[model samples]
Target: MSESKKFSVYLMATLPIVFWGVSFAAAKVALEEADPLLLLFLRFAISLPLLLALAWRGGEAALPTKKQALVLIFMGFMGFYFHLGIQTMAMRTSGSGMANWQMAASPAAAALMSAIFLKERMSRTGLLGALCAFLGVTVVLGLGTKGAKGISIYNFGDFLITVSMLNWAAFMVVTRWLFRDGGYPPLFTIFWEVFFAALMCAPTLALLRVDVGAAARFGAPTWEALLVLGLLCSGLAYAFWYRAAAAIPVPRLMVFQFLQPLVGVVAGYFVIGERFTPWLILGGAMIVSGVYAANSHK
Candidate 1:
């Protein structure tokens, strides 16, 4: 790719990371007033129209084959329905700091899964950069013994987050598989994925007895957070992610995930009075350098 094209690809990839980074803060705000399962349902419900519209506009909105439908449904369930729902619930018990700190492991998990299943390999420099990025995120998040303990019976939420991380890794690999040889455009695939996620979540809402009526009581801030989560994070961000993942190697793209926690910390700083320290500066530099190095050509 030319310099300009590569820059655009990187920029496109960054869009979702930023949306998801701020999403931790948004979910916190919304969860203060809404049930976690309700929040998850609303996220998918609100985003569906937008995704469908986008896919339709792009002229890629054809229905999938039986096999494609199955894969897309699996993607929807694993990626959005299960992963996001579990993560949201986990945050209620464990808190966003713990969640973000644990999420820093996702990129490494993704890279490993890509290597194993997709037969993708990163160069030595890329691996080094990935390690550096991972360390940067650990510093930026200030993960300590409190949250980093290996999962025990008491750490149920932590265990759930670990599951979310692994599920995310598998989701990335499956998405790459769908797109590799020939598949629908990102928006089209994302639309169907989210469609099935929302469809599957509908029954769960009743099984869990989530009060859908609670939405009537949502305040302006709560509604605003929901809209942002739905429209931007779930809707546009997923599309942007799939697009980038389709075009870029999974391992190389996974390196960019290291910035997510840093973004979350910055978002927290502004939204919730989290402090900015010297660690932020040092860690931010390492993360940027690592992403550049990992994505650089041999």
Candidate 2:
């Protein structure tokens, strides 16, 4: 690609990462007033209409075949429903910044899974990078004896976050399998996934007996937070993310993700009064460096 074209691609890819980074702050604000399930319900409920409108405007074709539809639905369940549910739950127990940091594990896990399932191989440098990233995560989480205390066993939020990361990795694998042939537009597939996620989440919302009254009690700031999460983070962010992914090489595009936790950590510190400890910073650096190295090796 030409230099100008490459710069544009980087710019486009940066959008989603920035949006996602800001989302941690927004979600932290939203969760203060809204229940986890309610937060997720509102996010999907608000984004659904906009996503459908975009799909319509794009003149997308009909739904995929029965087999494909089933796969998409499953993908939606794993990626959207399960993933978001776990993440929301995690946020309730763990702070948004920590949750975001933990999520940095996804790309590392994806690389490992790809190697095993897709027969992809990475260079030794890449393996070192992945290791560094893992170490960073450990440090950020405070992995030693003191760190163990930092982990809330009773909270179960951290466990949920770990599960969410695994689910996201699985979703990536499924997405690769379903879209490998490149028959359908990314938006179309994403729409179905969002649709299925919404459908599955509806029952969970009801079961949780989500209180609209609580949502109403939230002030404008909370509402604004939810709006940002729904519109920018979930809806437009995905659109841009897929677009950028298509435009740039996957590894290079993924480097933008390393910025997400950094943004989240800083935002959490300033906005939520979360501490910016040395261990957290050190761990985050390790995780980011490791992941970068691992991807580079590949």
Candidate 3:
């Protein structure tokens, strides 16, 4: 790649990770003003138009065939319903910084799943990496914000994020099975998966009977946070990610996932006052290294 192109590619790859990391802080702020369901709903709702415009500008049809539709629907449920939904709700107590740090294990979890379930060729290094990453999880669980009942409940928030991470990893592995040959553009998957996720999330408004007045009366900071959550975090970040994923080699692109947790930990400390303990360092280092090991062919 030319110098400028290389710079742009790096920028594209880095921005999404940064935005994603910062978003946990933004979500925390937005949650103070809105319920979890309401907050999540707004995110998907706001992003829908932007996604549509992107599709239109790119001259891509937004429609999916029946089989594609089924996969999209499953992705929506897993990505949005179970994954995002649980993560958002967990933030009620979990704090964004810690949650994101726990989420850093996602790629490792995916790699392990692929080895066991999909019969992928995983090196011994990959298996070792998976083991180290899971060990990190226990350390994080012990270090994270504990409940009133202490170890009995542990950090429910962190647990939820872990679940979300696994859910995401599963979606990725399944996507490989469904779209292995690069049959569709990466953008197509992002747009439609989020679209279906939004559809599935829509009914929560009726169940919650969300107060329009409260959402409307949210302070400027909260509104700004929501915009960041919807526009930058959910929408533009995904755009940048897929673009970078396409441009960069798989191994190089995969390394970028490490930045996400790093960003989250920093954001957590400054944004939400999450204490960075020694355990965090040890656990995070293990998870990051483990993910690297699992993803690396060498």
**Cα lDDT computed for each candidate against the true fold:** 0.84, 0.68, 0.70
Ten residues in a row with the worst lDDT in model 3? 144-153
Specify the poorest-scoring 10-residue window by lDDT in model 1: 143-152
Please tell me which predicted candidate would have the highest lDDT against the true structure. 1
Ranking by TM-score: 1, 2, 3
Q: Identify the superior model by TM-score, candidate 1 or candidate 3.
A: 1
- Of the two candidates 2 and 3, the one with more favorable lDDT, higher being better, is 3
Q: What local lDDT score does residue 247 receive in model 3, on the 0 to 100 scale?
A: 59
- Candidate 2 lDDT by residue in tens digits, 108-136: 67666766775545667865665666566
Question: Compared with the true structure, what per-residue lDDT tens digits does model 3 show for residues 238-266?
Answer: 77776665555433444456567656665
Question: What's model 1's lDDT at 263?
Answer: 86
Give Cα distance to truth, residue 9, candidate 2, Å.
4.1
lDDT of 1 by residue, 14-76 (tens): 899889888877888999999998999899999999998988888988999998898888888
- Per-prediction TM-score: 0.93, 0.78, 0.75
Cα RMSD for candidates in order:
2.9, 4.2, 4.8
User: With candidate 1 superimposed using the best TM-score fit, by how many Å does residue 128's alpha carbon deviate from the native?
Assistant: 1.4
